[model samples]
Target: MFRKNFIMSLMENILILFIIASVFYTSQSLQTQKTIYVPQGSITNIISQLHKKGYEVSPIDRYILSFLGQPQSGWVDIGAEKLNRVDFLYKLATAKAKMEEITLIPGETALLFFEDIASTLDLDASRLQHYYDQHADYPEAGIYADTYYVPFGINEEQLIAFLLKESTGQFQKISQKIYGTYDKKQWLRILTIASIIQKEAANTEEMPLVSSVIYNRIKKGMPLQMDGTLNYGKYSHIKVTPERIRNDKSRFNTYRYKGLPPSPIGAVSFDAIIAAIKPAQTDYLYFMKNRQGTHDFTKSYRTHRRNIQKAR
Candidate 1:
């Protein structure tokens, strides 16, 4: 009877060793290293996935791995040739997703630009555009242009929040450097003036002078008469002819209307926004585009007319 008990104990020890070895082997070998998408669900979902992936895991082994971690929802690239049980569990528990980088260009309207951004992220462009139109209270004029990053699986609202937060941080830095004072009314006017400068100026050097023209007209109560201000809605710079100006009676018609436009035309560059805040100290009220792609600044309507004739 004692001998029978001894043999039974030895067999039980061997069985325990075999189970440990099998588990170790399972972890060291992943059928093939591939990307696995473990969505947010119960441990049962992960167990089913392991079976679907051609991993011959026993019920006990599945429980062991599942209980080790909660399922993280994302596309995780499992780069190892073979994953031991622990490694597989660790990778699934952590959502190590790839990031996508995108750039925002100055002067693009919010509708078009947001669509482009959504396309790059493989998201619904119309959804993103609608979100921007409905939620964002601020105009597009002062949005900072720069490259930004977004993680995989980020939702539309989350993406908008990230962009707004980053742009706010960028605007704050520039505000401190240039505006020096935080006044909402003043900033709105500055943004309006900056958008005009961004649209009208040929280069950085001309931005301040374009700003000067805007300020000078506003101060003297003279009609802005800027073609850029008329470049709005479905129509743009091409619609600023004498015929359109006479017939059109919109508030943006700077030739007929008085001061600045109701809102900015599009997003402005940092340089343009800064120039709007600090315009060139010039008495010139007129600017005509010269042959050299630069503008000829003049104080009198007579010189402005002569420049127009020369342009013709």
Candidate 2:
């Protein structure tokens, strides 16, 4: 009889243990992903909140964190996002935050284009312009036109650093490919010529012809009487008026000055830059745009004048 009673008591204890194990398993099985936001606050408070939101925050975990260190203020995805607390913390501390992107327009002046970037990123327009001016050796012509992805909430200083690094790196790579060295003065001169090519050409297809005309004029020591040179600052336009072309005394006036401008007039495109490096091998000295939305290349002054008369 004593043996049987002992066996019954042992079975009851096993049943009770099984019940407890089942309850624990049920609770743990209910786990699901949640998007938790850990804002900037006291570390202890943050951990406590993390526990309430279903993280396995125990005294041992807290002790481990005290030795391992905690991450800075940022949103961490944990406890249901297929990541443990440790994994989430490590990523939050080390990895860059979520990214946002914007595209820089080709041929737009950095001073004006930066404002558009500022508007897109919700940054101060003046501050953006100032950053470009301060960092870029070539100012408006320094930055490469492309889509850029930056970390969310990145400050102006960080953005400027990124822009400088990328622009310099791209220039170095392309310049070496084209000219065999990163010649600062030569690169600047090429950009000066490229900027004119970028503006004068109706499209990428027309850039080479326009570039040839500029080079031809330079070789002949004839004044580059291209009206595109007058398109700058407040006077920027497609068609140069007779009054402005003749009367404008600005140094940018190719009608008055004999060679390339003091600097690039605006940001230039990749094709325009290439066109400046390798111009079409034509004897063309002048270009006049026709009604077909492209320019007509002419080798003689008489022919250019005849085309101009026909257009009128």
Which candidate gets the maximum lDDT versus the true structure? 1
| Candidate 2 residue-wise lDDT, 9-116, digit = tens | 999999999888645543442332433455566657667776888766544445435555665554333435555545544443444345668776666667666667
lDDT of each: 0.75, 0.74
RMSD of each: 4.9, 6.5
Candidate with top TM-score is: 1
- The TM-scores, one per candidate, come to 0.73, 0.71
The TM-score of candidate 2 is: 0.71
Please give the lDDT score at residue 250 for candidate 2: 80
Error of 2 at 166 (Å): 0.8
* Candidate 1 collision pairs: 27-83, 27-84, 27-85, 28-84
Compared with the true structure, the alpha-carbon lDDT of candidate 1 equals 0.75
